[model samples]
Target: GAGVSQTPSNKVTEKGKYVELRCDPISGHTALYWYRQSLGQGPEFLIYFQGTGAADDSGLPNDRFFAVRPEGSVSTLKIQRTERGDSAVYLCASSVQGARRTEAFFGQGTRLTVV
Candidate 1:
């Protein structure tokens, strides 16, 4: 894909259900990140992956939220025991790994609604 691609732009599930959100980053990008945005707020970092390993996942709220990037090209965010408070837009961004700052391209995001 030429840009970051997120599947199922909108997802609605009952409380306690499990959901998996997918993100396909731009080809050749070596860095990927997952973020969450609640209503009226900027995107909050959830996780960051460098290559196939997660370099930073401390931003994830709890054990219920997890993310993985197996091949370094695509990533999946898994949410367990979903709650209404978890409802938010999940954003994915990717950038080239470099010592200098690189621009990141973001996907439109997947809106998860816990009802």
Candidate 2:
């Protein structure tokens, strides 16, 4: 890990509980992503792996959201019941592989608070 590496950061579950957000990318990148910010705007992709499949995931926003990246560097973002508008701030990015336009590496989020 030398860049993207999200973890606890700040999470407060309640409304239904069931959250698992984690992303550790940077050792090789390969194009991993998952975004969601809600206090103002921007960042709202949701899913997009490239090595372990999930080319897009259509910006997950239903079925309680879901994401994964088996061995493509590490990635996981599952949120079941939880509500309260599903508090936001859960980003994670990476690059290299196909570059998606270049410039990625971003991991300083994971602020879910669905009390």
Candidate 3:
């Protein structure tokens, strides 16, 4: 795809259910990121993947959240035991891995509603 693509733009899951959000980054981009945004807050970094390995995952809230980029191209965020507080927009972004100044391109985001 020309730009970041996220599947299931909108998702509604019941509490205690599990959900998986997919992200297809721009072609050739090696730096991929996953973030979550609540109502009025800015996107909170969840994890960052450089190529096929996760470079940084410090922002992941707990063991229930995880992200992976097995092929260095597409990524997926997995959530377990979804809670009401987990309802938010999950955003995916990508940029050149080591360019001096590469701007990240973001997807429209997947709005996950946990009810």
Candidate 4:
């Protein structure tokens, strides 16, 4: 695609349902990231990929959250047993690796609402 693309711009689910969000980053970009934004706060890093490997996954709240980028391009975030606290905007960013400038371009985001 063109810029980053995220699926399910908005979602409403029960307090304990599984949800999957998709993201397609710009072509040829070597770095991809996922972030979570709660109300009245900045985006918090969730995970990052430098290619097919996960460069950083430290910000995930728990083991229930996971993500993958198979071809260093498109990625997906899988959440199991979603909780109300998990309701927030899920964002994706992509940038070139080691560019000194981490001007990450973000997608519109998926607003996941766990009722």
Global lDDT of each candidate: 0.94, 0.87, 0.94, 0.91
What tens-digit string does per-residue lDDT give for candidate 4 at 2-112? 798999899899988999999988888889999999999999999989988898899999999999888778899999999999999999999877366778989999999
Off by over 4 Å in 3: 98-100
Candidate topping TM-score: 1
lDDT of 3: 0.94
RMSD of each: 1.0, 11.5, 1.1, 1.1
- Candidate 4's TM-score: 0.95
Q: Which lDDT tens digits does candidate 3 get at residues 81-110?
A: 999999999999999873547798999999
Q: TM-scores for all candidates?
A: 0.96, 0.32, 0.96, 0.95
Ranking by TM-score: 1, 3, 4, 2
Return the number of clashes found in candidate 3: 0
Per-prediction count of colliding residue pairs?
0, 0, 0, 0
**Per-residue accuracy of model 2 over 53-78 as CA lDDT, tens digit each:** 88888888898888888888888999
Q: Is candidate 1 or candidate 4 better by TM-score?
A: 1
In candidate 4, stretches whose alpha carbon ends up further than 4 angstroms from where it belongs are 98-100
